[model samples]
Structures are given as structure tokens and as C-alpha cells.
Target: MILPNSGLMIPWLQSKLDTARYVTAGDLGGEMVADSRKAAVLIPLVLHSSGSTVLFTERAAHLSTHAGQVSFPGGAYEVQDLDLVATALRETHEEVGISPARIKVMGCLAEYFTFSRFRVTPVVGVLQPGFELVPDSNEVADVFELPLDVVLDSRRFERKMVERNGQRGFTYFLEYDGRVVWGATAGMLLMLAKSLE
Candidate 1:
């Protein structure tokens, strides 16, 4: 059966996002970065006839950090940035060429702490229809879209035990086409999926 609501307004999305229960990567036996470096990422929601899709990027293989790993378009906070939301928008624009003017900031998810040593804030935003993605050679290797339904489904994910330098814990991961979305990225996406429910 086709759903009656075809599109979501910014206000409706904002309400859901505002009340979202934020979850972070569980304790991995580390200090969890008490004075962590602040960063932000944009969960780019794109509208379509069927429903909404999410935009993600693969980091360039040549990059020193997390090279070739799939992640949302985002980066560290700069002094020039007005706020975390602005940082997310600026990085998304820089890495994917999606201008801020074409985006409507709906809401945000809970802050997530990464084992890689950064405190990341996931910002939720809706991308207007028909925005072309221009991936930066130095930052993004590829840009792709995933069905929001796929990401939102709890049944599609599995918990896997992981160890990093002897610190062991379970993490959520979803496999798509040969790529793995795990760690903090998956954790943030989990929050988004739960929020949308």
C-alpha cells in the first residue's frame, strides 16, 4: 500500500529530530575523549518520489586518516565556523559540493564519541531535489546514496564483536555491496534511524 504522506516538512522533521534519543559508540575501555576534538557531520536527506535517501561518501584512498572508509560529509570545527551546524554545512559543501543554500537544516542527533578520538555531532538536513554531487578529489573518493528505508531497518543490521588494541566491545554494522558501515558512523546512523521512527 502506498503511504499518503509523500513529503515531510522541515518542521515535522525538526520535531522528530529534536526528540531523538542519541546513542554513542559504547565503552571500548578507553577514556572516551573527555576533552575530545569537536567535529560535525551532515546526514544529508534527499527527497524523492518513492521516499527519502541518505547521502554518504567514501574518503579518498590517499588521505592519511580513515582512507577509503565510508562516512558522511563533514570535518573538524574551525574557529571561523559560527557553530557546529555551520561546520557540518561548510564541510559538506567543501567535500561534496552541495551548497548550503540548497539545504534545510531540520534537526540533529546525539553527539557521538569515536574511538579514532573525536567528538562528532550529527546534523540532520534535507537536501532539495536535484542537487548534483561533486566529490572533492582530495577528500572524497566517491559519493553515493542509500535508501533511507534500508538504513532505518533494525532487522537489516547485526552486532559484531570488535577489538581495538585489546579493547573489546560490540558494534553495529550494515553491509552494502562490499562496503562496511561500522564504528561511529554506524552508531550515528542508528540514532538517525531511531529518531525517524
Candidate 2:
């Protein structure tokens, strides 16, 4: 089921972002002090027979930085790309083998800051049903899907405090099985949830 058009969250999110004032890039938290790079990511939502699910990938364990972590299939923007949306769609096809033609891009959500020193623009897209997936072995360890409703449910969201830079900071965490979903990825999802509301 498509969660009824009533609960389709992207419309509400678009409205909020349209009217809200955005802070300058410098004012954003979690920005890297070193060379800050620009990147784009795709939040691919698939509507399946079981339910609507969000697609995520587990990074290969041997890679440097953020290895063995669950993430959306994406990377830094490339010069050849025309725009952020193209970057996202291209990256998603390269990492997960989902054809760009199969996606209907809804719009873009807020930009997210990563601890790894990259400012990422997350493009929201809906995957057409019956599309095939071919995961790239070099970059992705495994591909998995989680019910969208479960993720949107506020009861499943939790916050934890951690000591960073001699001060305690609270971060949102989403638990599934024994795996932890936190950091920038989770933050983006939380922002999407807020927009949905």
C-alpha cells in the first residue's frame, strides 16, 4: 500500500522548506574545519507489496572511514554532473545498479552535514515498482530495506548523549536488530520525518 495520499510526507516537507529561512552554510553544525567538499545523496523510497520501504546499503568493511556502516548509496558530487539531483541519481545507479530511468524524483530535502567533512544534499526519489537491483560488490556489502512506516513512527526514534569535544551532545539513534542507525544519515531521515509532519 502507498500509505494513502493523506500520509504522503513529501508534500508537507516541501511546504515547510519553502517558507522557512535557511541559515548560511557557515552556521551549520558538524561541518569539517578542513577542506569542505560538496556531495549529493539519494533517499530512495520503494513501494513494495509488503509495504513501502526505504532502501539502504551497508558499506564494505575494508574501505576507509565509515566502513561497515549502513548508508544511502551516494558519494561526492562530480564536475561532469549538471546538478545535485544528477549527482544523486548517478551515484545511486553506480552503487546499487538501479537505473536512473526507474526513479521519479520528488524533490530535495534540506542539506545535511556529515562528520566526515562533506556537506551533502539529499535528493528524495520514489522508485517504480518491479525495478531490479544489482548491488556493486566493491562499494556495497549488502542491500536492505526497512518499512517506511516503521521509520516514520516517532516511537521508534530515540536520542542519546555522547561526549564530543569535551561537551555532551545529543544525537538521534534508530535501532534495528543489533545494528545502530545514527549520525548524518539518521539526522537526514529525522529531518525528512519532520517535513512529513
Candidate 3:
């Protein structure tokens, strides 16, 4: 796969994700919960001279849901937010301290619906060099970067059936740093990775 360097990624990815033919996890068939909760996630791509990487956060173990799981910086939409995009941007800043000014919003992926009842929309953004992270301990345990090269590579992710007892469907998983990236979060990444292909 021909990937773009950090400096050139904004427009390239913007056009690609914004215009490409894509499919979300919901499209792959998932048994969603009743009156699904609407949410969004920021797929923040940090640009550097070496290459690009997608930023991910480890949810705080004390959290009631998705604790210790690796995911993008985001959460459920708030009533104050205008849209899912705003939800993503606001949550990104709140969770990781990367201000909206440092990021150039590219586009968004189709929403991924999970058994947990979230209809998550993945918002793509390119983080200009020098963006900093100050994670909120209450919501985030740690922050890490996943190389875009490795993330966009097909070999890194595996497809498996999600056997949620009576609720069954497909999801993708990519292991990194001993933690599992799966379900709705990994599914969003899978959609982005596949869209690039």
C-alpha cells in the first residue's frame, strides 16, 4: 500500500476517506442494543518526518465500561455538542488534551454499531507536528501511538466471529503491546484500513 507522509496526509486522507467507498461494522451485521447510544471517536493521525501514526488511548481500568481497552479518544455525544463530529473533537481534547487547533479534521467513517449499544462514528483528523497529550486519568489510563504503516497493513488485523451468546456477528482484532483491540473500536479501525485499500 502506498501511504502518504505526515505533511501530505491531510489532503490525501481527507479526499480518500471523505470520498472512498467504505463500509462500517454495522454494515457487516452486528446485533445492536435497544435505543442505541450515539457516540463518536477521533482517529487522530500524527504526522512526522519518519511517517504517520494513529493515536490511541487505554481506557482507565476504573471506568465502568471498556476499561483497559485501547481505543481512539472519544465518547458518547453530549447534548451541548452540535453533532457527532463535535462530540469526537470535544472528547479528544477532554480525554487527551490535543486541542482542535492542532488538528485538521479530514473526514468521517460510516458509523459502527456495537452490542454495547453505541453507534460510533469514527472522525478522521491529521494532527500537525508538535501536538501534545495530557490524558485525563479518570477516563484514560495511558496514551499510545500505532504506526499508520502497521495499522493500514492488511496482515496486522484478523477477522473473527463475535459470539456474544445470542448476539453473533463479525469483528476484527489487532494486538499491540499485549492489549487487544477489538469490537467496535477495532472495527472502526478496520473500516479505515480497508478504505485505504
Candidate 4:
């Protein structure tokens, strides 16, 4: 396992990603829907003096879908975006005011299929210190950071039985402070953690 030191984490993560056999839809017990919409999310790792932390956003309460849920900064692929990477960067900037210039993208995780029928690609990146956030109030309710160590440690996750659409199964979640991270966001985090192992 990679140590949580800021100095060691970046390169160690890159190496792990380099050799990673990325997950696929089938591996997650689902297949991509024929009409699935493409989306991207930025998994931004911020370098703090204490250690590294991951940035996340709470969606605005008024949103029609996934309202008030913890999520990465991202959205559906735009016609103007050159690719999914650009889509992730563009959405991050629009949602949290983290300019694309401030993010140094390391790699991408597998495409995560949401029950909402969006195939979301997770783009991993690192941000150096000194970046300021100017979150747009319309789409973002709050912005927060969780320590990288807490996120990467597989043992930190909590699994509970949940019934969705009348089917009972396990759902994974992570809690920090008073906030909960679950759903597709938590699934992607688990994927990253497993990849590192």
C-alpha cells in the first residue's frame, strides 16, 4: 500500500494507475445501456501541507436529479468539449471555480454506469496549493474536502443493506464530519481504492 504522505502519494498513485486493469461495466454487475448519456467527473486531489485531500461538492437542493447529494464536479458531455477530460475540467470550473489550469490530470478510472443511465467517467487529477474556489450557488450547495488517507483506506467504508426498486442489496458509503458520500460517487471511490490495492 502507498503511504499517505503528500510527497509519496502522487507518484505512487500514478504508478498504480499505470498498471491498473481498469474496471468495466460488466465487472460492476451492470452493462451500459444502449441509450446511456455520457458524463464525466473530476476527482481532484488537493495537496495540503498536512497531507492530500479530495475535493467534493454537494449538489444544490433545488436540482431535479440527485439533489443534495455529494458528488464530484462534473456533468453531461457537452458538444463543445473536446473529450471527456475536457468535459470534466469544464464542469469542475463551472461548478466549483477550479480552473482547468490548476489541475494536473494523472489518469482516468473506468466508466461508471449510474442507475440514472449516465455513463460517468472519473478523471483523476492533482491540484497544487493556493487555488481559490468561487462555487456557483445555482448548482453547488457546498464544497468540502476529505483527507486522502481516509478515502483510500478500504476499511473506512461502511456497507449496509438497501432496497432500491424493491430489490435488496448492499450499498457502500463513507461519512466524514456530518456529510455522507454515497451512490455513484462512493462507488467510484471504492473502485479507485481497489485499483490501488
Candidate 5:
């Protein structure tokens, strides 16, 4: 399968998501928890001379939940946030210091429910060049980039069996430069990867 190239990523992604079947909770071998809280995450993609890359944040180890996990920049929905998209942009700016103005939102992927009872909406956005990061020390421990091509390549991901809350199930995982992206984050990437096919 061919992946989106540098000059064609924006339109390519938009078209793919527009027609692709969304990966709901059940499709990932899970179900949404009752009374799950709403959350949103920004899947930030950047264009570079070599190619496109996706930005991910390492959650601060001090945080109470999902601490030290590699994840997209986001958080639970707030009352004042306009919508899921707004929630995503707001949390992304707060966590990684990327201004909302610099990102062009392409579209949203299907909601991915987490074991923590949080329903997450992954918003795909492309970043304009020359942006710098200033990750908040309280929420973000580090920031890193992964090639979009590498991520979209389905062969790079591994399916593994794991137990959560006394139940065993399968999950997807991808490792890059010593950082492992798994759980809902890897699921979202796999969803996007399938779209390209």
C-alpha cells in the first residue's frame, strides 16, 4: 500500500478519513464503559523536507494517571471548551506549547474508549513549519517526533496479548527510538494505517 507523500499528505489524509470506516470500541476488541468521560487528543502531523512526522508527548512521571506513557497531547473535556476539536487544540497547546493557529485540523478519527473510562476523540491536524515546542513540565516530560511514513506502515506494528483488569485481550504496539506507543494511542495509529489501504 502506498502512503501519503510530503506534498500530498493534507489532501490524502482528508480523503482517506472522509471515506474510511471508523474503528469503534468494539472493533478494537473492547467496549465503552458506562458513564465514560469525554476526552480529545490532537494527532499533530508536521511537514518537513525529508517527509511528514507526527508529534507525541511523554506524560510527566509525576502525574497520577497514565504517567510516563507516550501519548498524543490532550485531556478530558472541559465545560468551557467549545467542542471536541476545541478540547483537543486547547489541551495540545497547554501540554506542548503549540499554538492552535499553527495547526490545520484535517478531521477526527472515531472515538477510542480507554480502560480508564475516558472516551477519546483523535483529531488529526497538520502543523505549519518553523514551530518550536515548550512542553509544560507539569504535564509533559518530553516531546518527540515519528515519521508519518513509518507510522502508516502497518508492518511496523506488533499485535500482542495482554491482561487488563483481570481480562485478557489483544492490543497493538509500535516502538520508535526506545519509546513505545501502545494502547489507545497505537490503536488510533493502526486505524489510520488501515485507512491508507
Candidate 6:
């Protein structure tokens, strides 16, 4: 059976996470670094009659980091926030005009480390149908959606290795609309797909 389109229904997506293993293990066998910055990202799912769709934004080219890249709506965590979930929601509102009230947060996915030293938690949320989206022109270049089915299909996900700092590392990439979804954002989605499966 296919996964539900609404974010409200994702808990039924199943829990593939091995909580014991994740919690007991440290750093997934990588060296723990002190510079790890805590961040959060919003993985907004829009349920449609056709299928559930995942939303993404193209960052403005002028941004200092990850400019013109496709990314979820999120940013670094702030001390004033209650938790990572709030950071995700606030960032989504600032970047895409998506009100926190309109989102039904399912839960958070496992944290993924970025090459830039950020440890980001992905907050999964469902957007009610008929909500309007207003992209922030200064930060977001464009907003787009991809069918959830397309993203969940294992055949479409590919792994490629590239050399960094003289060491070969692996990365995940999802191709759609002539655009590539990769890096930390894609890694989080891959984990979501695994959880759903």
C-alpha cells in the first residue's frame, strides 16, 4: 500500500528507526566534533488527490552558504525558541510564509550532519489543503513540489561518490524536473522513505 498523502497520517508510515541502536551508539562511528551546530529543517508535505507531495525551495544566489541550492525551509536554531520544532516552523514562516498554525507536525526525523558542521533535525509536517504559499523573494528563489511516490520509489534514488579532502565520500541524489536533490536535504528524505517502508 502507498503511504498516506496527509502529513497528519504519517505516524502510520511506520517506525523504521532503531532507537536503541541510534541512542546507544555514538556519532554513527564517526569522530565526534565539538563545532557541531544545531539546526532544524521543515519537511512540508502537501496532501493532494493525486498523491502526497514534498515541498522545496531554491535559495537565492546571494546567500553566503549553499546559494541557489534546493533546500527545505529551515535555519540555525536560536536560544529564544522552545525547541527544534519551533525553529523549523519559524524558519518556514520566514522563508515561505507558511504559518505555524497551518502545519500539523507529525514528528522529527533523525539528525543528519552537514559537511559544514551543522547537525540538523528534520521536522515533518503536513500542510492542510487550500493553504496559500508566499515565497520570500529575498531568501527563496522559487518554490516547487515533487510527488511523494516519486521520492519514495527506491529505483529513483541513486548514490554517487565524490572525493572530498582527498577522501572518497558517498552522497544520495534524487532527480526530478531536471533538478537534483542531494546532500543533507536528500539524506533526510531518504531516511523518511526508509521509515515509511
User: After superposing candidate 3, which stretches have Cα over 4 Å from the reference?
Assistant: 27-33, 163-166
Best by TM-score: 5
In lDDT terms, how accurate is model 6? 0.77
Sequence-dependent TM-score of model 2: 0.82
What tens digits encode model 2's per-residue C-alpha lDDT throughout 1-197? Answer: 12533245446545655665443231135444366688888988886655678899999999887788888888998999999999999999999999999987877776776656677888888875688889889899998888787777666878777554354556677988666776667777776666665
| Candidate 6, superposed: residue stretches over 4 Å from native | 5-11, 14-33, 163-168
lDDT of 4 by residue, 75-163 (tens): 99999999999999999999999999999999999998876778999999999889989999999999999987788777878877665
Per-model TM values vs. the true structure: 0.88, 0.82, 0.91, 0.92, 0.93, 0.85
> What total of clashing residue pairs does each candidate reach?
0, 0, 0, 0, 0, 0
Pairs with steric clashes in candidate 3: none
Q: Over 4 Å off in model 5, which ranges?
A: 26-28, 165-167
* lDDT values, one for every candidate: 0.79, 0.75, 0.82, 0.86, 0.85, 0.77
Candidate 3 per-residue lDDT, tens place, 28-61, comes to 4744557989999999888878999888899999
Clashes of 2: 0
RMSD of each: 2.6, 3.8, 2.0, 2.1, 1.7, 3.4
* Rank ordering of all candidates by TM-score, starting from the highest: 5, 4, 3, 1, 6, 2
Write down the TM-score for model 1. 0.88
**TM-score, candidate number 4:** 0.92
User: Candidate 1: where are CA atoms >4 Å away?
Assistant: 1-6, 9-11, 23-31
* lDDT leaderboard ranking: 4, 5, 3, 1, 6, 2
Q: Which of candidates 5 and 6 reaches a greater lDDT?
A: 5
Question: What tens digits encode model 5's per-residue C-alpha lDDT throughout 122-180?
Answer: 89999967997989999999999998888877788898887665666788889877889
